[model samples]
Target: MLGVLSAMLCCGAVSAQQHEVEMIPFGNMDQWIDRQIKESGIIGGATKNVYAIGPTATVTETKAYKNMGGSPWATSNVMARVAGITKTNTSVFPEKRGDGFCARMDTRMESVKVFGIVDITVLAAGSMFLGEVHEPIKGTKNPQKMLNSGIPFTKKPIAIQFDYKVKMSDREKRIRATGFSRITDVEGKDFPEVNLFLQKRWEDEKGNIYAKRVGTMVVRYYTTTDWHNNATYSIMYGDITGDPAYKAHMMRLQVEERYAVNSKGESVPIKEVAWGTEDDVPTHLLLQFTSSHGGAYIGSPGNSLWIDNVKLVY
Candidate 1:
């Protein structure tokens, strides 16, 4: 799931002059939708709360979630029904920040034990992005298939700005736990990251989604820092492969294709064809903030990323 939208860039030292800022709807992180769900009796029958970034409201039903109040944001929190058993997972929250609220994403471990004998544990990293997460997740297989990772965004913005802070896990190595498999170690330290990509996309007759990378901007937090306000990261347009600042491991075309529900209402792969030219105008935009750099079911527990006041600079 992490590879679905993987890309990175260094912080740009751009001057803040003659810049216009536009706030994304609900991007301020001050409003939220709260959901109350009750787990199946087989899983201990407990009520849980799952949250989404949307207009203020409370949902008590267990139905699948759709973006509400015209909000274009979704989180990793979800309601899942597997093998006739319903459960919930929540790693994103709204925390008080000054006079408003900010998003708090945490990397942690979750466990499920049935009858005090059958045990399952998995690592989940908190994330927020500009798309949708199809809910009532059926299974753990192909998690990337469960998400539509971007929204139609035709305009090109110079950079993205936001207030943020992070607490790194500070571990030398990361770990992976899929619940069904034994937890294993992964090479490299885990860092919280932010990514933005613009693409000119089209759909084929077979319902396949394809795109060329039009713009890219990504930043990884290597160390803990205090809240930084109005931090801006410029987007690198067009083919950045030859750029001296490019890091293949972090900014290359997605090795694994991402998924999007097509016009036919079928979930299909979004194949990244190539990088677009420098002057290309994008058809869509993909953006995300996560508490861990690694993909699904992988990360170091206790890592946290806080974000607020997200805006785009023109």
Candidate 2:
């Protein structure tokens, strides 16, 4: 992936006739970091592999992962330690694509059985984003706070391009499984989605983050689709509330506040106060690809999304 980025950046700019495309570091999904984690001996002592989008390396130590090699990508694959027992969950994988690889995200149920008696099941939806997942997760409380979303980015790209394929679940309604409660049916069908937000953000004296939405681009797949190469979605700048393309359910302000690391090294919530003007330059970019559009712990089990060759068009 880094090699591909280097080649694209070497051209300085693509073609003057066409849109200039800049390959994001590790966005090609060719390289990955593999972690081999050993669960607690009480739970059969199984070794699990968790992956991340970064420099290619195999990590043997069972430790929390931070983004490495200047990569600006993170995944839902993670390790958790709760009640003094260690476990792992992997919903994202690096799948072979031609001579390289692509990210395959699956929405499914993960199970953990303890002492051959207690069995627990949780719904996990695979996701990839431009931020970090704080680990090892201690508990299920406030899952949003456990993630540091977005990254410092100043450029204003016209659109985002990527190759993708989606497989919708066979069920008509989504399901919710929190591992602590019985699974219940959600109202509507789930969809695979891609969202990108550009924001001008700031922090107050109390360490609370606020932002005005500078740009937004969101696309959801309602049905299964074959491989779409170089699919591009234009970024709509400023307040799009009156735009004909706007859909309230998909373009509304984030319902749950996303977290970011503050200057004091504390995770603080980012509040989207309002919309920005068309000319506003952004201070940060929040980009994500997910197998499920619904919130955490909600999705159909068989849904899957595959992505490769992500880029920003200038």
Candidate 3:
């Protein structure tokens, strides 16, 4: 009797059969049936084509493929690239002790503004990005010369400054600036602290380079042809100690990226891909000196000073 009672309470397991149930928590029934079916995630349902893509570092790896050791600058395997603008006869070296980078006066401006793009662009061409010129202000000449003039504070180390324009798309954009640390002693397998100056120039000085900001690019204007001047930002990439690695060839550039918020509270780096010494034009981002106006007030008696010797170092 007990066995029969148990049999009445329990039923036999049935074979797996297909059946449907109400997926809508609460709705107007068939009104959204099609929509519900679409979102139900039914097997073999007309789902949009989707494929899982892993992170870049992950997609780059797979069981069928061999594992690549590290990044381009990895000691086990390092890579360097400085491609883009074709080496035209017009091109000149931006920094010293190197080859194949056209540099010249922008000649597009009449006067420059403080913290303006023209000022930044010209400065890069004139000094950090090209030549480390000692041009002073218009009436106030000799920032560097005044230092050499046996003046007390003027003789002290100077802060490096830079201003530049990163071309913006008609749409929103991101940016990053990276450079190989100046190799003081490549043969010695050693590197020193990577310093950054306020501006991007200093014939010789130990000013704090990274104190104020990191990976910061001031977007002066939002419009392509702007109401505001171009954005100006730069950094000193040389050693304050005046070492030789400050002149060594950078195998690869290590650029850090900074961010800005959008119409939404969402923020992104200034660059989708950090600027590097790649030669590709569109894809390879560079701080090309499109044009400039103002320049350093050279301590010259009469000659107008030129900017030169701009470079990237670790």
Put the candidates in TM-score order, highest first.
Answer: 1, 2, 3
Shift of residue 272 alpha carbon in model 1, Å: 0.7
Per-residue C-alpha lDDT of model 2 across residues 201-257, encoded as one tens digit per residue: 999988888999999888899889989888877788899899766777877776457
Candidate 2: RMSD to truth: 6.5
Question: Which tens-of-lDDT digit does each residue in 273-295 have in candidate 1?
Answer: 89999888898889999999888
Off by over 4 Å in 2: 1-17
- Which residue runs of candidate 1 sit more than 4 Å off their true CA positions? 1-10
Tell how far residue 180 is off in model 2, in angstroms: 0.6
The residue-level lDDT of candidate 1 at 97 comes to: 94
TM-score, every prediction:
0.95, 0.94, 0.16
Predicted candidate 3 versus true structure: per-residue lDDT over 1-314, tens digit per residue? 97774553232111122322111111101111010111111212222211111112322211111112211110000011113111001111121212321122221112222333322111121221211111111222222221111001111111112222222222121111111222121112111111221221111132211111112111122222312121112322222123222222321122323222223433323332222111211211122222211223211111111222222211
> Residue 64 of candidate 3: its Cα lDDT?
17
Q: Least lDDT summed over 10 consecutive residues: which range in candidate 2?
A: 8-17
For each of the candidates, the C-alpha root-mean-square deviation to the true structure, in angstroms, is 5.1, 6.5, 30.7
Model 3 spans > 4 angstroms off: 1-167, 171-196, 199-222, 227-314
